[model samples]
Target: MKAPFFLFSIVLLSILSSCGSNKELQERAPAQFNEVYYSQTENGLNLYIPVAVIQENRVKLESVYFRGMHSALNLDAEKPNLYVASFATGKGDKIMHEDPKEEYGNKAPQAPKESPFKIESDEAILVFKQNEKTKYYKLTGIEERN
Candidate 1:
């Protein structure tokens, strides 16, 4: 009777110890990060980029509103052409754009309107097409965790 009970207890203890802890997972996944959070509109834009250095505790958050974005956000005034880009600790994000005007010092690649910049990770880059006729905005945001 005692032998079987001893073996079962040993097995249970081993299984419990072998199970990984949260801290260990975090250490193993040092670079693992996500966009975490983002929100934007015609009025303003918000982004959160967690620093790999800070790992899980710190993040960089920023929000910017173009000079004329307010009017467009409110549908009460005129807007101008605009563009934006960003990078973070998460997977990554990219915003490719196409235009008659060259941007990003010529290295910027022109993208097809059918498929706008694809943001698939922690880093992201976006371009705003604003003009006297600018009327609508395509807002994008991604939140991820693992």
Candidate 2:
């Protein structure tokens, strides 16, 4: 009787512990890294991204897509089906590194630039970032697979 009860208690404890083990917050890598998606419809576009590339004190998500030119055109919920696109971005999350300055500490980095208007797809993650002298980011195009 004692042996049976001990075994049952151990099993139950193990089960309970495993349930909430992952519930606690933990530093997790970008869940959307290297992920991409695409869509092209009537007067519409879509691009799913889940990556990060910090440059010039800006996060400039590698996985998130931005719209418009240098003008910070805030995309609305209707802008792109973020829900269907996979991972999305928020204003506060422009970059995802601890220090913005450290990201571009490599050398006399060129100025920021923008990608020309010529995205030939619905779902796309194309961006252009410019800086002081030359074009820092010419065209960071991101294409989704399947």
Candidate 3:
């Protein structure tokens, strides 16, 4: 019937659209990321990436996905060709204000399942825009500095 055909078409479209093209995302980024590093400060973890944009088109660095968290990158005012992202590493003390009845109705939430494309601990996925298209570049073997 027409209804069944329509449902099948929708399902097919969904699957196709969900698939991303990673041909441009090489194993390593094209830019010069030789000094990409991170440091753990009292406030949080500060990531520093010194990039040399070589593409003809201007590359807009979007965000960094690291350690299961996504953070927006910002250009440092004092440094050129450098992008930085910060992650809060400290957790504040919990306040003693809660209601057992309102807390999930006495049922604890289920544990979160692992994502299919979970990022590695020592690697980061940089989401950027070039030529008006969004792209991802993986930077591996990141080192930590004191």
Better model by TM-score: candidate 1 vs candidate 3: 3
RMSD of 2: 18.7
What's the ranking of the predictions by lDDT, best on top? 3, 2, 1
Give the Cα-based TM-score of candidate 1 against the true structure: 0.19
Per residue, candidate 2 scores C-alpha lDDT tens digits across 27-110 of 332223454454443223445443443243533323223343222212236634132322222212233468877555333212
Error of 3 at 52 (Å): 3.1
* Cα lDDT tens digits for candidate 1, 35-55: 435444333343433323422
Instruction: Return the candidate ranking by TM-score, descending.
Output: 3, 2, 1
Which candidate has the highest lDDT of all? Answer: 3
Model 1 / residue 76 / CA error / Å: 24
Cα RMSD of predicted structure 3: 7.3
The worst-scoring run of ten residues by lDDT in candidate 1 lies at: 67-76
Is 1 or 3 the stronger prediction by lDDT?
3
Query: TM-scores of all models?
Result: 0.19, 0.24, 0.66
Better candidate number, 1 or 2, judged by TM-score: 2
Over 4 Å off, model 1? 20-47, 50-146
**Residue 1 deviation, candidate 3, in Å?**
7.9
lDDT of 2: 0.37
